[model samples]
Structures are given as structure tokens and as C-alpha cells.
Target: MNCFRIDESGYTGFDLLNADQRFQGASAIAISDEDADRLIKQHFPKLQAPELKYRALSRREANHPRLIGLMRDLLSDFRCVTYVCDKRFMLTLMFVDYAVEPFYYERGFDFYAGGQNYAMASMLHMAGPTLLGKPQFEALMAAFQRSMKEKSEEALRDLVAAARATNWMELPEVLGPLAKYAAPECLEAISTPDLTTDVALIVLQSLITRMEVMSEGRYRVAHDQSKNLQTYTEFLQRFIDHDANVEFRATEITSLKFPLKLTAVEQVDSKDSPAVQLADVMIGAAIEAANNLAGLRSGGLDAEQVLSLYADDQFIHMVPSIDFEEQKRFRQGSQSGELIDYLAGNVFGPKKR
Candidate 1:
């Protein structure tokens, strides 16, 4: 049976709006225990730690070069994939679902029918602050987060207050289709918003899709996030028992039968599993690479090596779309556009001839 070591990074529990770590995700790598050991030994011959941690190694000047060498080796592997999501973008999407989509849904229509969700998600992500003011926009997100946790009267009041504070006439571009739902009663529809399991399932689903093709549907997930994802055992257990269908709704419908090739999901300790440690480096590199693209890490970043080493489709980049017009209006596309183009180029590594 094939074994894929999986690990998640940048998770802040159910709170999606974490300030420090904006990216949360998981990576899956298919490798034997022996290969993982051999690679680690080759790179860190005088290793002293029980586990090879990417974050720790990147911090030390002497070890940074070795870390990059190890990452390049890992990237050379044929089978690996990383799925990352922006927490704020996820929350912004939820707001559109709760406050905006329902109005269209009531009229026997799909809110996301015409790439509308992408447009709205991008618009709200960028224009929301301009339309509602940053404070109110944040309050509304907090309200959405709280409302989904449980029925909180405080969350409801905050939602109402945020809606009441919005002057629809100011930003008609966003408020045009959204104005109908700008009222407090319409916003009250945000009673359920579960983002916790949402991300985990996406990570798992994407991992399963790629693993199915790579392993011929015969593999078990060796997960290493027992603390933050303790509840995931049951969800993964479904695959072990029967052929489960995993589906994701986005631009299109993605559905597949699982356990056809998958056996079980074992929650392994990272300290013992070199495979999981390798997965750690892969996922951490993905996050750090994104940070580099966003200019989050202004200082030296050995992790930037991931940009060149990454396979075109290996790393998934899911960042929020900034209000492009607003950016152009302020900087005349001098700063933001240049950064955006640079990021795009790095994301896929110069086009093939």
C-alpha cells in the first residue's frame, strides 16, 4: 500500500482572521521512509534534532543553504501537491454567501452561476474597506465568524450595526447588486458559517484527487496535525470503510470516489515520521514562497528558492484580489502592478516554449 505523509501549516484553529500567519494549508508527498531518511542524512549529516523543521533551519545562517538544497531535492520528486488558502479571503467569500448570494438564490438563481462568486469575492475583498470603512468591514467579518460559531446575540448586533452603518449610495459599483441585501434583516441571514472543517476537507479532497492518480487509488494518508485537527480522524475514516465521494464546488463541479484506492488515514507523530518532516518542508516552502511573492518577507529568504523549483501546478496560490482600480488610482499601477506581474511570473515559473 502507498503512504502519503500529510501536514498542515498556518492553522489558527477556527479563527480565520489570524494576524500573524495569513496562510493556512496542507501538503502531501509520496515517499518511502528509507528515502526520507537517506535525504535527511545527505543534507544534515551532523543533525542533532529529532525532526528537520523548515522554520528553525531557515532562521540559522549556517543551515539556510542546506535547507534550500533539501527543498530542491524534495521538489524534484514527481508526486507532491500543496493547497493553500487565505483566511481573510475565505471570510470575505462567506460574507458574500451570507449577505449577497441569498438575494439571488431566493429568485431561483445561483449566486455563483456566472463566475459571479469570483468577481464578488474579489470585489468585496478590495472594495469592502472603501465601501464600509475598514472598522465596519472588520466588524462584519467578526460578526460572520461569531455567528457561525454559535447563535450569538452580540454577533447579530454587530452584523446589524455594520449593515446600518453602510451608506449604499457611496459605492454603487459594489452596492449595485449588493444593495438589496444591505439591510440588517438581509444580513441576519448569516446564521451559519463553518470555516474550520471547510479548509481541512479542501486540503484532504485535493490531496486525494492527486494521490488517486499518483498511487492508482491505493494509499493511506499519514496525517500529522493531531492537535489542531484532532477531529479529522472520523472524516478520513470514511475512506477506509467505503468508497466515499469527495466533491468541491467552485468554477466547476469536482467529484470523485475515494477508498477505491485509499485505505486508511493514520495520525502519525511528526517526530517519528521522516516522511511527515519532508512534508513539513514542502508545505512551509509553499507558504514562505507566497510570503516572498507578497513582499511579506522583506529580508533575506532562502525559501525564495521554491519559486524556481516549483512545478507549474505543484503549489496552489489562493490570494485575495486587491481592488485593482483602487491600486491604479492611488499608485498609477507603478507599485502594485509591478509587484502583481512579478508575483504572477514567479507563481508559475516563466512560461514554457
Candidate 2:
């Protein structure tokens, strides 16, 4: 089998498992070129070898977020694994979207497991259906494209209506293309062509739930102090009610002293800082909520399936410089006077690419 191994300090990727005996102490491991080919053939019998491709990502060229975003873009719908090689690595059977195309081929190698390590692989593949007709695949893709274009609920309703009217439901069984656009609510409505009382009730319930969530976000962002306080109080009540006998303490409370007064030369962190580390917690919550919303809309949860959305990694960058001539002056190290003048020109500049 083509496979790769990463044993604590050494790692290697290859076309065959000839050196399988050397795989030891691997924090994470994955199959290589030849083994990978065999594995895919074993599990996805219908998929052909020509449809598979190798992709590697290096830490030196991209950070984790950027790497993840790229992974989502290129292999969101494909299976991939990492082998603790400080790189994003994966093998894909198909291109999910525009994020991955015209795959490139490159080569370089390093030592692994007390021996020389080297391998060759291509990063792209051309997709062809195993049995489904080309026109069938094309129609399925058209449905998917229609779904992607319908962002609003009303638009989604229209697409769902049109799909049912045109009999696209039968396509999902033979082609995976419609899976991206198949929504649960639409499925329910389709199953019960006539809206039953239960279906109506469920739709109403979902609407109420969505409205409550939107109201909460609005309250927080609009600085509606009264609403925020009321919402917090209700949350505490529900939380305390969950285990009435247990002691409970508020973990988050606005500090009584904010923007603490300090004399010159007395170092103190900004009082605006949070008492607890919430930046990471909030970021995680945001990711989870977004994931949930995406799942609710799509009616499926495939981590790889949604990768294309984040392919173009966007991030903030900070560059230190002043206006035109002064930036050049600073770079040139004109003089001590120039340094002071540049510093005085602008204390901070906006983040730039």
C-alpha cells in the first residue's frame, strides 16, 4: 500500500509501503501514494485511480487558519489525513468546487526514521462518473448551482418547489450532487405533498426558535441594556433551575472598577480587559454557531463537504509605517530626527495587506 509515517522526530511519504517496518512512534500516520491508491480502491470500489490526487501544505508558507481555509477550499468534499509533518496533507477523489482545480505537482524530500525519505505525487485529478450518464451529472450540478444561488429562505422555498415539480428528487439516489442542496424542511414538505397539521406546527416552532436567536444577537449588539439584563436574568433562572440544590456562582460579571486610574510610570493593564479569557471561547462559539446554521440549512454535517466556503483565507495584517515619504525615511534609517518625526507623524496605522 502507498502510505506515509511520522514517528516522533522523523516522517516520510512514499508510493509504496516497502519500509513499513520502520513506522514507529508515529504521533499521527497516513497511507502513502501506492497504499493510498489501494485503500481508496478497497473502500470506494467504484472510484478509479485516475480520480485521486495528492496535496501537501507547508507551515512555512501558511498559518493554521489559512491552511484550514485552504483545506476547506480544496478538499472540503474529499477525504484527507495529516501525518504530523508540519504540513497540510491529503488525498482527494474529486474536486468539490473552484477552490481545487488544475492540481499542481511538486517534489522535495527530507530524512525520516533514520533513513532517506523521498516520494513523487501529483496534486490534481480529473473526475469522471463511474456509471451515471454525463447529462445526469450535469443536471445534478445544475440543481446544486441553483441551491448555492438561493441564499434567502424565500429563494430556497422557490428552488425546492421547482425541484419537486421537475422531479429532481430521483437524482440524489444515483448522483451525490443534489446532496448539497437537499434541505430537511424541503424534504419534509415534499414527503407530505399536502402540508399536514404536524408539519405546520413544526415550521412554526422553527420560526419561533430562529426569531429568538436573532433577537438575542440584536439585543447584545444594539446595547439594549434593559433587554440584555432581562435576557441574562432569564438565563440564570434556567441555569439555576437545572440543579437547584447545587451551589452556583456567576463566572462572568462586569467588574465594578473599569478604566482604573493610574499615575504616570505606574504600569497597569487596561481596565477594559476581560477578567476571564473569552476571546478564544467566543471564537469557538462563533465557529460552532456558524457550523450549526450551515448544517440546519443544508440538512447534513460533513466537515469536508463545506470546505469550499473558506478556501480564500482572509485575515488581518499589521504593517508598521507612516505616510508616503516618512515610510521611506523610516525604511532608509534617515536619522534619529527622522525616526522621531516619523513616529510623531502617525502613532498607529490601519492594518494593511
Candidate 3:
């Protein structure tokens, strides 16, 4: 069995749109402990206290070169697998999948099967605020997000009120399509709490599956000690044990060998685990590169070099970005309108009804 050490960056539980926690990055490496230590010495020969895991290279601007150098090893030597997601986009996806999808599914339509969830999430993320008026839409999203963590009747009522509040607050034409689903009738779907609906937990779960698919065999995992991981570790292990089929519109999405291979999950101190620390640098660098790429922040790391490492092996890396113009305070530069223009001008066929 191959041992993989995994670490995460920008993990802020469920409230994702906070200014500092916009994206979640994770990297898993198969490098042995001895090799990882040797590589660390080369990167930071004079490393002192707190070690590389606690003092991550991706955190400081000065250490970016060493991060890129180490990332080269990930690209060539170990062929590490990584995962990154725009948390804001992910929240919108939860809004669509959890709340909106069920509205249609109850009527016998498969929301994901039809691939409407993707389009809906993208549209909402990029233009929902503009179409519906930013304040009310954000309020509605906030209520839904809070209810995801707490499944109380009060939370459900707030979400329903937020949805209905949009009728008067949003543009008339836009509310017609959304009003039905957002209506309180769909409270059962929206209010049903799911432990597995968490972002960090979901990232780790998806990354593990992708890792299994990329490198076949039973797996042993070592993760950095975290309350977050501890919070969802059971769900993570349980998620893999099930051999359920994931069909999107009558097509199978799972191709990994049966019983879904996993041997054990161990939470370890990064001070003791060389590979976890190394994985930390990789994940941190990936998140920095994503910020630079998204134009949310610029010049903390080499976007070109970090992104090139991603191109080396496509299957082992899953980096999905949802960057577009928006009027949000944190998304100030999004007003440039470059991405939105491209999205609009792209040629595409309409989905089948």
C-alpha cells in the first residue's frame, strides 16, 4: 500500500465567503518520510523551530522560490495529486445542489444529470447579485449557508424568509424562474442537515477518490492534526467504504476498482510527519498561485511556475476555478469585465429540456 500525506490551506469550515477564506487548497504526496526530510533540507537548509509545516513557505512572499523548487519535485519525482476549489463558487454550488436541485428532482428531473446545477451555480456566482440585486441575494445565500451547519427550525424559517424577501428586492423578470424553488415548499430539502456537506471535508473526500483513481492500490493516509479533520474524519472514511454508483444523467462517473481502496486514516503532528509538512508547502503554494491567477491578489508567488507544475500531469491534479466580474467589495478587480465578456461571447448550444 502506498502512503499519502495530505495537508490543506485556506480551510475555514462552512462560512466560505469571508475575505480571507475564499478558496481551499489541498495536496497529497506519496514521498516517504526520509525522502521528504532530505528534500526539506535542500529547500531550507537552515530551518529552525516550528518546522516547515507550522512555518509554511506559501505563507511568506520571500519563501516562494523555495516553494517553486520543491514543487518541481512534486511534478517530476513523486507525481503528487492536488485539489483546489473556489469556496465562493462552492457555496453557490451547495445552494444549487442542496436547495435548487431537489426542487426539480422531486418532479422527476435529475438536476445534475441534466447538468443544470453547473450552469445555475455559474450564473448565480457571476450574475446573480447583478440580476437579483446584491444585498437581498447575499442575504438569502447567507441564511442558506448558516442553515447548512445548523438544521434548526429557526434557521429554516430565516432561509425561507430570505428567499421570499427576494421577490420585492430582486428584478421582476429574474425572480420568476427562481421563486418556485426558493419558496418555503422546498424547506425539507434545504433544511435537511448533512454532515458530509462541508467544504474542507468534501475536498479531502474528493481528493482521496481522485488519488485512488490516479494511483491504484490500497491506501494509508497521514493528515496534519486538525480539529477540522477530526470533525469529519469518520465521514471521510465512511464515504469511501460505500460502493455507490454516481450517475450524471444516466452515465456512470465512477471508474475506480471496487471496495474503493483504503487501509487507514491517521491524524499526526506535522512536527513528526515530514511528508505532511511537505504537502503543506505544496497546498499553500497552490492556493497562492490560484489567487494570483484569479487576479484577486497578485505577485505573492510565481503563477506561471506553479501553474506549469499543474500542467505536467493533468489527471493527478484537479483545479477548477470560477472567476468572473462581480460588484462585491472583496471582488473589486472583477469589475474589469474580461472573464464575463469571454463567457458571454463563447459559442455554446442550449441544454435539452
* Top lDDT prediction, candidate number: 1
For candidate 3, write residues 1-353 as lDDT tens digits.
78888888787877777887677868888888899999989988887856785234455777777777887876678848777888878887777766665556557864553334555577777777776668988897888788877878898777767767774344332233245445443556555434323576556655765666666667778887887667545645654555544311111232223345766778999889888888887777777777788788876667777777765343222222243222122233221122212212321111111
Backbone clashes in model 2, listed as residue pairs? 1-35, 2-32, 2-34, 2-35, 3-31, 3-32, 72-307, 76-304
lDDT of 1 by residue, 145-205 (tens): 7765664677566665555566655655444433434444334455432322245554565
Error of 2 at 16 (Å): 42
lDDT tens readout by residue for model 2, 75-147: 2432222111111111111112111111110112111111101111011111222233445433433443334
Candidate 3, residue 149: the lDDT equals: 74
Runs of candidate 2 with Cα error greater than 4 angstroms are: 1-157, 162-273, 277-353
Q: Each candidate: what lDDT?
A: 0.64, 0.24, 0.63
Candidate 3: Cα lDDT at 227: 78
Per-model TM values vs. the true structure: 0.79, 0.17, 0.79
TM-score of predicted structure 2: 0.17
- Cα distance off (Å), candidate 1, residue 307: 2.4
